[model samples]
Target: GNLNERKFLSTLVKENEVIVDMFAGIGYFSLPIAKHSKPKIIYSIELNLESFKFLTENIKINRLDNIIIPINGDSKTEVIKLSKSGVRAQLSFLVLY
Candidate 1:
């Protein structure tokens, strides 16, 4: 995603809102959103182990561990599990492609 788009998206996030990024590769969108937006929590799901690793590291590096929960697995399956577990988000970013 473009930097401007990320910034714009961040602004759309309301304080204390819960967000879910279905394809949070290396926290591309998650990072900025977690940083600029005061969301209560962000469930970032990534399938690639390598990308997931970077996502976790980025969360720590950005000091957003509390707000961003990095999950390593297929987003489709993970999302189903999350829903069953009663994890709800006010906004969900499902960027395909």
Candidate 2:
């Protein structure tokens, strides 16, 4: 379907890279990216409660708990906290989808 872009982007992620996925909807792109790329850490921020719930469930189902961190709230505020959390790794990408 619409996985071409996601598939391509996943190839760009390197080891120990950090990612901040804004507007992550039910781990659609994030899951594929995480599964394929295996970044050091990914902060997936979702605003919709239902979607956020699914996001967490998906992460768990995929056993990516140590890699993908699910944030249930507005990306606008959560991004700031993540940026200030002393995550010293270089950001590999900011997935806006």
Candidate 3:
């Protein structure tokens, strides 16, 4: 991951904004945003179970469990489920690399 990109992305997050990370990947982007951006909540979705596990652990280690919700499943499917459940995000990050 690029440190500059992560820092830039974090700065874009406004206070009380809701964020959805399509490929959380152990909370790479999610962690920074949660820790510095002051978002109200972040739904961090990861398809890989191993990555998801680390994502949860990272959230705990960062003491951001209250701000980041780690989900283990396909991002698209999980996002649809979240929408149906009335979870709306002000910003959604989908990184492809």
- Top lDDT prediction, candidate number: 3
TM-score of 3: 0.96
Can you list the residue pairs that collide in candidate 1?
none
lDDT of 1 by residue, 9-95 (tens): 999999999899988999999999998989999999999999999999999998999899999999889989999999888999987
Q: Using lDDT as the measure, name the better of candidate 2 and candidate 3.
A: 3
**Which ranges in model 1 have alpha carbons more than 4 Å from their true place?**
none
The sequence of per-residue lDDT tens digits that candidate 3 reaches over residues 37-58 is: 9999999999999999999999
Provide the lowest-lDDT 10-residue window in model 1.
88-97
How do these models rank on TM-score, best leading? 3, 1, 2
lDDT of 2 by residue, 1-97 (tens): 4799879878878877888888887987779888998688888889999999999999999999999999898878887787798755455344543
Model 2 lDDT at residue 66: 90
Backbone clashes in model 3, listed as residue pairs: none
Off by over 4 Å in 3: none
Model 2: how far residue 72 lies from native, Å? 0.6
Per-residue error (Å), model 2, residue 47: 0.9
Best by TM-score: 3
